[model samples]
Target: MKAFQFVEWQRPGEVRDVPVPEPGPGEVLVKVGGAGACHSDLHLLELPAGSRSFAPPFTLGHENAGWVERLGPGATGFEPGDAVIVYGPWGCGLCMNCRQGMENYCQVPGLPSPGGLGGTDGGMAEFLLVPSTRYLIPLGDLDPREAAPLTDAGLTSYHAVKRSVHLLGPGSTAVVIGAGGLGQMAIQVLKALAGATTVVAVDVSADRLQVAEDVGADETLISGDHAVTAIRAITGGLGAELVLDLVGVTSTLTMAAQMARVLGHLTIVGVGTASLPVSFGSPPYECAVASPFWGTIPELIEVIALANSGKIRMLVEHFGLDDAADAYQMLHDGRIRGRAVITPHD
Candidate 1:
């Protein structure tokens, strides 16, 4: 079978023929359906080898959905031909967080925390071997190709927004920075769950902002010198009660902090390496700032439920396995409007 692999550190991943994996006890094998091309993949390629705990030569995708092909011994609850979404995070099942279904915050040491994140070979292939059925969620009637991104793009946004949902009340405001794939998902999520909270979307790309509006954003603004003022004015100069920074660069972070209301929540969900030095007045007093990782298992189920209910859907551009590199290039150039999805099989 052919798979895209990060064969070396500080280099681009390539499609290569590899052995089709066989699932072991308690594991399951899934035929490749669709794999999301995330910006974090580009970041992983650019990052230095020594920066992470895992080395390369692993399959390169994390956001994935597919149909069950076979089950290893002792695997139950799902049968062959059932559609499923693979959870991105993989942690020691015995850990306290994993026991609570919060494997995103897996406390185990010395293993790849997320299934496709590091050392774990991911779903960018003809087949993926999931270590446990715990990482697989039934997709029901949803198309695996279209629903693949819910594993990461959708789940991550849900986690970030759900954490700060308490601040989103009727007539209150929430700001979403970077209206790309994850940001667009955040917009729909806020609309579905935030209830009557003004959902504002910001991005440098006017085209992407337009998509945000089509999805659910109540207001859209271009990220620039006046971005802060626009957000303030939209919230009646009180600033937004919740700010989600999907773009974690310095400038966006600065604008995010400025747009945050006092006693608000600012959550950074991007993978950018930029850092912000907090001070007395930067984020306002009583503001709670945090960088949340991917969603919990229960949250992932909820995200899938939202998708299944037609409340949220990912706008995806499909690519065959051979064109996966082109998909990555387009995503890196910011040419893809929404999520870039690679269909490893027909």
Candidate 2:
């Protein structure tokens, strides 16, 4: 099996031949069909030695979609050759969060907290071993490349938008910042699920803003000092009721706060490492700020259904497993307009 691994931090990933993983009890082995390169993967590779959760020599692609190659004991309802999407979050099957179908937030007895490619050997190879059968969700008749991004970028946006849906009324507005992979998905999710009359997207790149508009954003703003003011003007001085910051940097988070109406919600969904200093302002209206993790399994199912129904469209570029470094560089350089997928079959 060929895999791309992190031999060291702040260095290029290495492509090597490793032993193919086998399914253990209650586990399944998936032949990698497609794995999306997430921004977090780029960040993990750039981590300055001591800040990373997982060390070197780990396979690092999490957003996985493939066919079941082998199934272990007690892995019922799925058999070899069955098309499936890996849920990516591994957790205890009996925990409270897992019981509620929120395995992404699992924190319970006898199980470690769920972490995807960052914590375990992921699917940037010919074969991926799913630690639990519960993480497998069947993808009926959908292309694996399209389903790959839904595991993380799509689900993360879905969860972030779901939080402030009530605020995005017919007359209300929303502003999505940094129109990258997650930002592009956020626009589609806001249009499909939240009925915001005004969907404004902000980014430094015109191409990304164009992608955002093509998806469903009512307007796009080139991010800068004028971005927040532009959003406020579009909302008729009240500003948007929900502002999603997909860039999580200090500037974008500050702009989100500046563009949100009093009593509005600002959802931070990006993985950038910048910090924001929060303070009370004049005529404060109970502003709520939060950071959302990858969504629950049921939410992933809903997102898949949304894609299956043709409501959400995925824009992807395919790369071979050997070109993992190029894929990472494309993402780092903002050269990818949408999601970049690695197909192990190559």
Top lDDT: which candidate number?
1
lDDT of 2 at 111: 43
lDDT per residue as tens, model 2, 154-198: 988999999888887788889999898899899899999875468
Q: Kindly list the per-residue Cα lDDT of model 1 for residues 1-346, writing each as its tens digit.
A: 9999888877878999999999999999999799999998898888887878788888988998999999999999999999999998888888888899988888877643665577789889999999999999999789999999999999999999888888887889999999999999999999999878999899999999999999989899999769899988888888999999998999889989999989999899987879877999879888999999888899989998999999999999999888888898899999998999989987
Clashing pairs in 2: none
Query: Model 1: residues >4 Å from true position, as ranges?
Result: none
> What TM-score number comes out for model 1?
0.98
Candidate 2 TM-score, C-alpha based: 0.96
Name the regions of candidate 2 deviating beyond 4 angstroms: 108-116, 282-284
TM-score of each: 0.98, 0.96
RMSD of 2: 1.8
